[model samples]
Target: MDNLTYGIIGCGMMGQEHLRNIALIKGARVAAIYEPDAGMRAASANACAALGLGEPRKAGSITELLSVSAVNVLLIASPNYLHLEQLEEIARIRPLPILVEKPLFTDPADAPRLAALRAAYPAPIWVAMEYRYMPPVTRLIEEAEAATGGVKMLTIREHRFPFLEKVGDWNRFNRNSGGTLVEKCCHFFDLMRHILQSDPVRVMASGGQANNHLDEAYGGEVPDIWDNAYVIIDFASGARAMLELCMFAEGARYQEEISAVGPKGKIECLVPGPGRFWPAHLGEPPVPQVIVSPRDPKGPVMVEIPVDPQLLAAGDHNGSTYYQHARFAKAAMGAAPIEVALSDGWWACVMGMAAQQSAATGQAVRIADLPCAAGLL
Candidate 1:
């Protein structure tokens, strides 16, 4: 594995973002891409050219992309519903090192299928949870315990723009995206588990499509994707976590504000949304920040966590995609261990599903009772 040649499936907006970040790596290049949409294919080609990387061979299908001899690794950035079947196809055709996007599977019924894939897949499969690598969030995770003296409560609040239009607008429907909790809020759930260092025992949530996409109808059907939610989770370690998400509040200065508190004090991180969306009049977007307040001091100390300009230009995730790709590349080459494994991805997805279920039924959902929790527990 002298160099990594990527075979990319679905070169849409997210896939193109991956390409930009991959260009930043020394030994990684996309060898081939499988994008069904002609417009997206053209856009991806233009993106590669703009990045000064040689144009990747356009692949008509996933099989064609996988068959490319130079393609030693894989990436799946397709729609949520297609993820499981695509992974199954990859496993059957060629089990190459893969980095798949989050919310591993959309349907709860597919959990058994995912479990089977997890059991038999013969290569490293890194789930893309880029939020974990965000500079501010990473800082919070690293210093939470020391700052808070063992975190007893954690809160993550995300107030940002609604879902961007994707190819075919597949994101507008719950059936396709596994509901707002699973599709968009999975990152927060994963963060809750990761930051607490414990699995969730139960989930309670109240969310609905209060705004955005309410009047928009595609093929005579209104969009059912939710725009806001509040989820409370009880962890196995006796810690409690809450998530507050509002997709219509894009005017806020910060997109994500996370805080953890304990008997000693509190620690919080403020992360801005994508710099591209920041109004030009506001000058540069707000720099990521971590604030620590110890009980003894009673004063808060805030530090700015700035990401590299080049990395920031590469993706909307505050340079997390680049960092995640760098680590995934190493894990693929056996130089590093997989930080976000199949189990981790499963737990994240399961938590989101449970949250949605709790919201829908107006009752708390027990994580242990979910069918997907069979082997995960």
Candidate 2:
């Protein structure tokens, strides 16, 4: 197909961000959208028109959207629980490329079926791990790959605002989101694997649902999602990754702080959230300076990761959504390979599930012991 027409499955925050980014990509457009919420559907159409992309046809149901002849590609950005079912539905219509959001599945129960589906599917299925396309994070990964002793240890920390309220409050339960680690921290896990270039062996974690949404009752049910977690992962190459996530800690200097340490040097990046004013006098506003420090503390160096001024101002992971779409478009057009593969997405979910299980049982969980780990491996 010379021109690609995308049908977005969900019109939520991520879905709308996709619409905004797709407008910036040439030869691609959101031809249709499937959002059940009437308000959100109308809002999505308005957003498209506002961006001069013209109003996208709003499909009244999933079946209607999938049947649209104008849509050549499908972008699945729906809630966690609906992903598997939607994937199954999309599979019936074969040869159409799909791009699914992170945390491949809410649970590992469907791993076997998904593996089978992948083996038989005709078109490419890519998962959206936007962090891999982030400029600073990419630079850090490149430097780590070039390090002398390889990557020894890595840490991904995010202390930011609480989870946003979804359309149905589905994010308040573990069954829906696969806990906070799977829902929100999968991106970090995928990044860890990409930087270290290894698979995880074991996971140990400690966390619980406290001080966030547990006290509130919506529809007479208390929230059961964890508000904080500290996870440690051991990879096969003796490299380790530590993730410290706190959902309630507000007003952080940076939304995400990532650092990778190797034998030769360490690379660290701090990305400020949108609208965060670090300093007016600073030459560059949002693009943070990367710090590279060698084993000897006396010698230190700094690097700048350039980002488009307009993209940095846009929402969704510091303009990563746009770059991700660019890459996806290229891959779909047979110009480049799929940057984030389905196996990597599944491994990320396995790591998250193991962490959640370990936190619940107060014991370390091995990745090889997880459900369907054999099939996945």
Candidate 3:
């Protein structure tokens, strides 16, 4: 664990981002990769070369990648549906510390499989909740208690562009990407719990495909992923949290705006979308900000939280991916504890699934009542 070497399962858009960030870390290097697509493999090589890192060996399969002696750590950035199976495959063959992307499992029936994996997996498995590490979001989480004097309510709003086309258009369908809520909003759900310091008891939502991807047909079927949603979650601590999501509002200055309020005051953080998407004509993108409003002061103070330009250039999520990988490397090297654990990932997905169910049935969904969550509960 002195020098971290990564074995990548997928090398698509997100995987390439991970590669760039991995190159930023001092002791981390990608030794082997198992990307099925030839174009992505070439792109990953080019990215590594641009970053001045040695070329990573290309493996045909996950098993082959795991067999490499230099690969002591694993990164699973594959398709949403393939995550669970690939984890299981790794566990069966050779278990290594893993940093897996969000929306851990797609189908409800797979909960038992996850439970089994949780029981058997020996190495650290950190779920990639990159938003939690964003500079503004991190500042908000750190200062929420003192600013709010015990938060009574929390709200997270995300207004951004539609999902980009993935390899083979897999992201356009619900089945492949675990629906919009679980696929896209799990990060918000995880944030709700992290900010509230409590688990959700009930979820009520109303969302549908109002805009974007309505007419596009793939394999003779239109995409069913939702583009907008309003979700209200009742936490076990009696605190209420809300999430507002719109996938067609890329024109908005900030992609994510989070607010927490209590009897004392309110604190809010504004995070812009990826800098690469910002129009060059606009001069420069908006910097991340955290505003604190004190009830007694009668004034609000806003602080600009600028990210490292190199980190921003590495990946999206406001340089959070790099921070997350830095911490994940520490956890993998036994220097620090896993911040986002398996249970955290499970709760995040469960909350999203509950929201999706509520929206579909037009009824509030209780977390305790979901059979899929029975194992976790």
Candidate 4:
């Protein structure tokens, strides 16, 4: 196939990001977008123009976008709660792949229904967990592989930006956003599963809503979701992880500066995200810094990994999303195996749900009980 045409649904902030990022994808192009809301529809047009792309041919509904022959893929960039309705439609549409946003569903209760709906689809559906595509993060995986002791532990104080406050939406609420554990931290859980190469056996978490009290003062409903959470993930490999969450990072929204203590060495990923994006804004940047500080029996040594030079410039956030899109297109073309397949997404959701269930029920949820795909995505 010359190009994998994608039909995007839900034209929101992330949708606009998709509009621009898809331009860089060599194997695939966003063929159309469907919003259904007049406000978002107009916004989508403005976004297309900003990207120097022509007006998006609007679809009256999700069904219409799937009907477009050139649009061989469905990108469900819609809000968290609005996913199930679209995924059900895409499953019957054709051989198209559906790329869903994170958290999978609005509530854990919908997991089985979504899976049953997906079971009927003759096509593949994947969740858009793009974090694993981060070039430096990928390098972290390589570094873990090269080490004889393997990754024994990691600690990251992940600070997030106030996007919900700026953008204004459901991410501010606990229910519609599927609570904090599933909504924001699902990506990290998936990334952990990808890097550790081991499924978490148990998750115990604790937190309560605190930061969004202004909602009540503004006459907005108080969200029940927790603003901060401390989670402990016990992986099958005996490598346990502790996650620190505070959505409002002091200087940046995200900062790992992770310190992984392995038997042979102590590897730290202190890569700053803002500095990475600043270079993209200024059009001056180099390869990502994936430094490994190894304290081997031979003494201390630092190693910096080198990835494909072209990837270094494209801003890892957008680049990783674009890379995953390209990879999906390649998988669709039968040129490569799907890295983040439907099963992968479902498993990620199961993991997140397990954590959520554990958090809500105040018990340790076991990964073994979560459903796994008996077949393909």
Tens digit of per-residue lDDT, candidate 3, span 101-187: 988998887988999999899999999999999999999999999999999999999999999988889999889888899999999
RMSD of each: 0.9, 2.2, 0.8, 3.9
- Model 1 whole-model lDDT (C-alpha atoms): 0.93
TM-score for each of the candidates: 0.98, 0.95, 0.99, 0.84
Clashing residue pairs in candidate 2 (N, C-alpha, C atoms within 3 angstroms)? none
lDDT of 4 at 236: 86
lDDT of each: 0.93, 0.82, 0.93, 0.67
TM-score of predicted structure 1: 0.98
lDDT of 1 by residue, 55-102 (tens): 789998888888889889999999999998999999999899999998
In candidate 4, what are the lDDT values of residues 199-297, reduced to their tens digit?
Answer: 778888876665744454233566565667778899888988777777556355235545566777765554445344343454533334555556655
User: Whole-model lDDT for model 2 versus the true structure?
Assistant: 0.82
Regions of candidate 3 where Cα sits further than 4 Å from its true position: none
Question: What lDDT score goes with residue 59 in model 1?
Answer: 91
Error of 1 at 132 (Å): 0.7
* lDDT minimum window of 10 residues, candidate 3: 46-55
Expressed as tens digits, the lDDT of each residue in 1-377 for candidate 2 is 77778888998877888888888888677778999988888988899888766667889877888788888888999999888778888887645888899878887787886787778877878899998877887777777755425888899988877788888888888889988888988898998888888999999999887689867788899988988999999999899999999888756767788988887878788876554444456544455557788876547688777778777655557778889888888888778888887888888888888888899999999888887576766
